[model samples]
Target: MDLLIAWLLTAISLLIIAQLPIGVEIDNFGKALVAAIVFGILNAIVKPVLLVLTIPITILTLGIFLIILNAIIFGLAAALVQGFRLRYGFWSAIFGSVFLSIVNGLLNQVVSR
Candidate 1:
């Protein structure tokens, strides 16, 4: 199914991101899969509410605050997963989220076609 494919792709993207020097680390594919699920859940549930609450700051910052919000969610996901970690704290989360987005976009494009 499409949802299964997307989940696997997200896990793969997490693994790819871990291989980079961006301070995101995943112990194995299993952990990557778990992290991906948690990340997806948090994005789906928490992100929208946070976005609404931070509208003023987001507007003031020209939408740049979304990056910080994404990093916070990324860090939260890492916190909830045993084998997934963001080294260097918030800085790592910021880079990890950015790279994750990039890698996911690339992987989805390949998988979709």
Candidate 2:
């Protein structure tokens, strides 16, 4: 259920991105769901490993680098998912990452509270 909610949020995010100045296209629910699941799994598994590996840099950057790492993870997830296309171009990825994080946080808050 939570995962489905996440997928729905991803779909909305993709739609919003497409409408924004960004060129992000999510063709359908299947792509959105795939992107969400892939993103979640990567965040859970790959992010931890990367964080540990980059602990020194993370500390040096005062954790701000984590935001870029998250953006990279989002870009990677979009790259891995078919039918959902994202042409983030670094800054766009950052914006898209922030957007996704905000939307997901709001949804979580709304549902949990």
Candidate 3:
């Protein structure tokens, strides 16, 4: 139940992010939902491993490297998911990931209350 809510919130966040002219594009709600699921799965499975591998760099950057890590995962999702696109490569992925994180956080806060 909680997982469902998180997925829906993530889908909503993706749709909202798509509205911005930030070089991230989602063709429709269906694609956004699919992308959200993919993003969640990647975050759960791949992100942790990547984080561990980059811990030294992450420490050197005072955790700022996580943003680039997030962007890489975001770009990976765009590549894997149909109808979701990141038009401007790494920069687009970075900004899109940041906005998505903010929107998802806000939505989760509202939903939790």
Who wins the lDDT comparison? 3
Off by over 4 Å in 3: none
Ranking by lDDT: 3, 1, 2
| lDDT of predicted model 3 | 0.96
TM-scores of the models, in the order given: 0.97, 0.83, 0.98
Clashes of 2: 0
Off by over 4 Å in 1: none
Cα lDDT of model 2 by residue, 1-113, tens digit:
86677667766666665566665667777777777788889999999999999999999999999999988898888788887667656777787788877777776688777
Instruction: Give per-residue lDDT, candidate 2, residue 62.
Output: 96
**Would you list the C-alpha lDDT of every candidate in the order shown?**
0.94, 0.77, 0.96
Compared with the true structure, what per-residue lDDT tens digits does model 3 show for residues 17-101? 9899999999999999999999999999999999999999999999999999999999999999999999898988999999999
Q: Which candidate comes out best when scored by TM-score?
A: 3
Q: Residue 113 of candidate 3: its Cα lDDT? A: 92
True lDDT of residue 106, candidate 3: 100
Candidate 3 lDDT trough over 10 residues, lowest sum: 84-93
